[model samples]
Structures are given as C-alpha cells and as structure tokens.
Target: MLMTTNEPAPAAVSDGMTEGESGALYRLMTWLSPSFPVGAFSYSSGIEWAVEAGDITDAASLRGWLAAMLTDGSGFCDSVLLAQSHRAVSDQDHAALSEVAELAAALAPSRERQLETTTQGRAFIDIARAAWSSPGLDAIIAACGGPIVYPVAVGLVSAAHRIRLAPSLHAFLHAVVSNWISAGSRLIPLGQTDSQRVLADLEPDVTATARRAAAASLDDLGSATFRADLASLRHETQYTRLFRS
Candidate 1:
C-alpha cells in the first residue's frame, strides 16, 4: 500500500513567494472540491436531529451551533488529532499515527458520525495517494491498513502535498463548516443568498477556530457539547430523517 506520487514537487517558489504557497493552493483545491468523493454530502453531523429538536431552525441558531462545534466539539478534537498525526508521520512514528487514528475513531459521538468520518477518511487516503503519488503517503497508508480516520488522513495528505499547517487547518475548518451549512441550507430551507450570507458571517469564527487549532495542545481536546452529542445518539432512533447524522 505504499503511496507513490509521479508528479514532481512544484518548482520552488520565487524569491518573494512563501514556502508551499503553490502546494497549499493545490491542496486546498483538492480538499475543497466537491468531487473529492469524501461522501460529505451524506452526513449532516446531527444537524437534522437538532433541527427536529427545535434547537436549530434559523441562520442564527445554525451559526451558534457551528460556533460551539468548532470551539468545543469534533472540530477541536479533530484539530488535535490532525496535528498529532502530522507529527507522527513526520517522525516516522507509525505507532503514534495509529494511536491518533484510534483517538479519531473514538472521537465521534455517534455511529453515523463515526462512519462518516472514517469511511470518507479511508477513501480520501486511497484516492489522494493514487492521484498524488507521494511515498510518504504510501508508507502511511500501508502502516495504517486500509481505513484511516479522516483527520489523520488529512494530516498525512497535508504533509505529503507539502501544504503548511496553518492554511491546512483553515481548510479543514472551512470544509467542516461548509458541510454543516450546506446541510442547514436544505433542512432549514434557507435561501441561497441567505446561505451565502451565513457563510460570510462564519468567516471570523472559522479563522478563530483555525487559530486556536494552530495553537492547541492535546490537553485542550475535551468537549462539553452534551446536547449535540445527545442529539446524535438520539438520531439512531429517529423515525424519519433526511441526513445520516
């Protein structure tokens, strides 16, 4: 399962350009592309259940939920895992990578969220390796078996593609927020213009989340979003549902 990349690294940036500027752009596009096949469209991260609970029924509520999630729940946990995974791969510590992977697997509060992250993670790694052909990625894929957790896969790909940590973290947050917002658009029936406005309002929160993630330590990983977790758990028994989680 050794990952192999045939494409040479992009030519070194010119004197004025920052390191990895081109690689960051390329990686951002890959991660953000709707066609990346991560199956992001299928999971709502429990927003549907929240909406049903009447906890979230408008743009303001959706924004609050997303803010809490980014600061206190899966977003924070995933950021820690992503950082650890990056270090593990950089150090060639396969054991550490596996540990972080397991942590990521356990981080999800519900079955659907667990499945959503891990399934897409495994797919992302497989596809990214095939398309990018990086040996570092190949080694990681081989070490981790076939199914790597999403954050770990993201960290590995970030390293393989030579994308810097800060921008990569921002991209990760944006992707998470975008998925939820897209789900909100359907479940709450927000207008397209409203969706765009909501996204705009979310920028500051997204940037703050990324900054915190960039500075976060493993000690900061605990979550207190009990209501959100309960909703996700209850989603299993939800009689009718639109989103998977």
Candidate 2:
C-alpha cells in the first residue's frame, strides 16, 4: 500500500534563501504523490510475475531485484532519459528532446512496459497542462508527435516549472521504486514494515543512480536487467494477474 503523506510541506529555512525553494518542494511532492492521477498503482512493472515466479519472496530479494533495476535497468534508463529531456528542454533544443523521446518510446522491452509508460505519460501531460500549463510541456508533446514516455513527460514539466533536474529525477525515481515496492508488498503479502525496510535499503542505489543520471548523456541509456525484462514478458501470459504489467 503506497500511501500519500498529508504532512505539510517544509517551511522556508534561513539558508540565505527559502521562499523560492518551497514551491518547488511542494510541486514535486504533489506531482509524485501516490494520489496523483497517473494510474501508477494499477501497473506492477512485472513484479507480479516475479513474485509468482518466486523471484521476489522477501524483503532482501526484493531489495536485490530493485537495486539491479535502479543501477542498471529501467530505473537507470528512465533517469537518463529524464535528465536528458530536462537538459534538452532547458537548452531549448527541440531536436535533442525529440531524439530522446523517440528512444524512450522504442526502448521498452515489452508491450506492457510500453503501455505502462506511455499511458502514464499521456496522463501526466494532460493533467500537468491543465494545472500548470507551460510552453515546455507543450514542446515535449509537439516533439513526441503523440504519446509521451513517462520520464520524458516528467522531465519536461519539471523544467517547465523551473525545478532543478537533480531533485526532480530523484523524486521521479523514488516514486517508481515505491510503486514497485507497493506491488511487491501486495503480491508477496509482506508486512508494511518489511516493505518500508526494502525502500530504506534502496536509498543508496536511488541516490547513486540519480547522481549518475544527472550527468549522463543519451549514450548512457541502456538496460541490463534481463530477468526483469523476462518477468514483464512472462507477465503477459500470467493468467492470474493482478497488475497490467
């Protein structure tokens, strides 16, 4: 159960500047919150198949699987795409943005993976534009010429909102990781505390991946998590599926 927090956003501190930062923090929290209308909860990114296959049976195994993802698989790939998209939008380089968008669209290893990302992506754009309309978001949609990939959509809007790439990418990846853990929780029937423990254990991987991605170029995009890919593939045939992927 990935739940949204109701705690108030932090107030501006006396760190030479606090006002400008508060809105960014609040926007990130709201945009990435579990309650955000992205249908993120409906897709397990193949975790259902992994659990069914006994590949993720406990917190330790779940952490290990997700660590690989954050460092070398879809997690890392999405980070790079997001970073590159952010930079592209910030630089106003429509060509680069379009290239990244095309690559992201073609990179999904499975049809369901494609569906998961594009569906959430299109939703993100429609929702964001309605609430936080910006030329940057419109630019990404124009470049994409159709549905946007999830990370690219987030990157475009974050840039449009003038949010820094580092924090935005980190937040996006964290949400992705949390969604996966939530799926694992329900599938493995793991306790809530155990689920949280796995999330805590993956913080290092998340931070390291985010840092690496912030400085990465399009060439850095690639996924090596073969089993994770296979899991999504196998999930297509998983008859008792509780997830779309």
Candidate 3:
C-alpha cells in the first residue's frame, strides 16, 4: 500500500479536498482496517465469555453490552489514552508519551487483556514502520518506552503522520466497536444482516464517545464497567473459548 513517489499525484476530489483529505483518510482506514494484521479477529475483548455467561444472547443484548463498553469500559479509556498520546507526540513531549504508554498497559484488567493490547501494539508498530516508515514515527516510537498498548500506537502514528485528531479518534473507536460486533455476531450466531444492523444502530454512540474522548484530558482516564472487566478475567479460565480475551 505504499504510494510510490514517481506515480502521478492523486487527482483532487470535490469535497474541497482529495480523497480522505489527500490520502490521510486512506492511511487511517488502512491502519485500522480489519485486515491490518493486528490479530484483531482473534480477540473478543471478553465478548466470548459474556456470550457463554448469557450476558449477550442476541443482537440487541450485544448492542447494549458494547454500548456500555464504548461509553464506560476499555473503549472510552483507550480513547482517552490515544488522545493524550497524540497530543504528547504532537508536542514532542516524550515524558507525557511514556506516561500514557505505561498507564495504558497497567490499566488492563486481566493478563489476557494486556496480551491483546500489547501484542497488537507491537505488530502495529512493526508493520507500520516497515510499510509506512517516517522520521516522526520513529521518533514517537523511541520516545514511548516500556509497554506500548494498542491505542497508544495508533495515536502516535496518527500524530506522526499529521492526521487530524478528530477523524483519527473516530476511526479508531469505530474499528474497536466493529471488532466487538463481529465477535458477538459469531458467538451468538447472528446473521450478517443482523450484525450490520447492530453496528448501524451504534453509530450515534460511536460518534459521541469519540467526540468526548478526543477532548478529554489524561486525568479523565478511567473505566467503570466492572462486569466487562470481570468478563475479561473470566475468559482466561473458560475451558471452551473462541477468543483470546
């Protein structure tokens, strides 16, 4: 997906900007897309346990479970971390970047959750560096020492590439919610149409959560969805499971 310099410059689109604002849009979609090789398909974020425990049995139930997560659980917390990490990188504040990176890893409620985030984080960095290398991206990576969580990696990359934070936040949250919906759809055995319906229904929630998180400070970082956190922990011991967490 690397754009060659020798190719002709992309033609501009009518939105007063080119496609996804001169390719920033395309980059965001590619990085967050389901096929990005982050192993996102393997992690259910605990939705598998929820299904086994009868917490999510249908599309509506799944919608409610994920709505709470987006608003109060890891979704919101991760968004905050991403927002702060983006700011830190934009400001070239290595200290702040490192702080959020550690916080993101520590906030994981369970070992599986930690693995889910950090494993994907490492993969994201490795792939992005190889395919989309840039001096700014490397600088952000160097500044963020210790464990790099998924959100932090996405945030820093967006910052390094000069992508606007608003769209980046929106795309990141949307991808998270979509992944959860996919997991629930499979666990509950919902039809594809039903799964799409659930995702469409949550559009408003996604937009609201992304907006709130983008403006939030690091001090606002926290998760209150105890049930979801417990679900993640329980997933570790479930004898039969389809997801990593």
Candidate 4:
C-alpha cells in the first residue's frame, strides 16, 4: 500500500540582508501571509472554470497547469508589475509607479480578474494601513491616484521598509504559488501530501520566474497562457462553481 506525508522540499537559504535595517522582513512576510485578509481564498483565478471543464482533474494536471501559469500567464504579468513597483518605489519615481499601477489594473482580462486584483489590493492597502502603517503606504497611495493591484501594493510596502528587491520578489511569487496550491487542494480535492508534492515540484520554476521578473521590464511582459485567459473569461459564466475566479 502507498503512503503519504506532508513534508515539503527544503527551502533555499536567504541572502542574509533580507532582514533589512528595521523590521522589514517580518512585515513583508506578514503582508503576504496566507492569513492576510486579501480574500485570496475566494478567487481561483479561473482555475475553477478550468477544473469544471476537465482541464485539471488530478494532481499531475494541476501541477502542469500551475507551472504554465507561473511561467507565462497572469503570474508572469503580476511579477513584472511587482518588480516594477519595487524599482519605482526605491527610486521614488511616482510617475512610473502610477503608470504601472494603472497598466496592471487595466490589463486584467475579465471582470472577475479585475475584481480579484483590485479588491484584494484595496483590502491589502486598507489592512496594512490599519495594522502596519508606514510612510511607504501613503507614498504609494498618493502616487497611484487610482486602484492598486495586489502585487503593486506589496511592492510599495516592501520598498518603503527598505527591503531588498530580490527576496521581496521571491516572497511575493511564493505567496502567489501558495495561494494557487491552496485553491487547488480544495478544487482538485487532492490529498495534503499531493498538494505538498505539487508545490515541491514547482520550487525551481517559481525561483526562476522571480529571477527573470527582477530583470524584466514592462516591454518584456506578455502572456501565452491563452487557455488560462479564456478559462478566466469563461469562469464569468461557469454554471456552478465554488470559487469567484
């Protein structure tokens, strides 16, 4: 008989400076923590639609779909936005910051996708201000002058706290993956062990994607995750679903 375990792959050691001059690292973790009231659990990013369509029926299929998302779809686009926001914040380039924030919000393919990013983003900013107030949050808010996306808000807060870009991006990407895995576990009804295994298998892909995002610019952004995008659009009309997409 086969057995299962919840053990995860060992994480790579940090680059040491991630701790920052103050409590930057801890706050960064708090902002991205699964418990963060972003309502991330409510949206499946169209994975629900895909699952209902039989595109993700098992662990292997879930893993494959997730891998493609991390590398090319909304995941890649969000990473780029996060990376740009990090740089813009670090430079205090308010114009660039606002531009990217607007672009990120506008690029959402469907109404649900827009709601997913913007609502979570608005909640993130509000909760952060209430509990983790900082000058950085204010700066980003004033600069943005409009709606924020989840990743952009995170980037601004991290930059304000003097957190280094690499680890910030790494943590942000990991949170995105973790949220998906959590959604997959429920939607796919995978065993905890299988979910953990899928996350473990994605370790390298996540790291590489973050690294590439750090070096990428807006011009480098594009998505070939066509099926995923369509699924997100279709989720708008999915007859019965457990997620809001």
Clashes of each: 6, 0, 1, 0
Off by over 4 Å in 3: 1-15
Cα displacement (Å) at residue 68, model 4: 0.4
Better of 1 and 2 by lDDT: 2
Model 4: colliding residue pairs: none
lDDT of each: 0.78, 0.87, 0.88, 0.84
lDDT of 3 by residue, 129-245 (tens): 899887767777987888799999999988877777888888999899999999998999899999999999999998999899988998888888999999999999999988999
lDDT of 2 by residue, 158-204 (tens): 87777888889889999999999999999988899999999999999
lDDT of 1 at 148: 76
- Compose the digit string of candidate 1's lDDT tens values, residues 64-168: 998888888888778777877776776778888777777677777788878888888988887887777876677776766546788888987886665666777
Top candidate when judged by lDDT against the true structure:
3
Any idea how many clashes model 3 has?
1
Q: Which pairs in model 2 have colliding backbones?
A: none
Model 1 CA lDDT for position 189: 76
Q: What is the C-alpha RMSD of each candidate to the true structure, in Å?
A: 4.3, 5.5, 4.0, 8.1
For candidate 1, which ten residues in a row score worst on lDDT?
1-10
**Which segments of model 4 are wrong by more than 4 Å?**
1-22
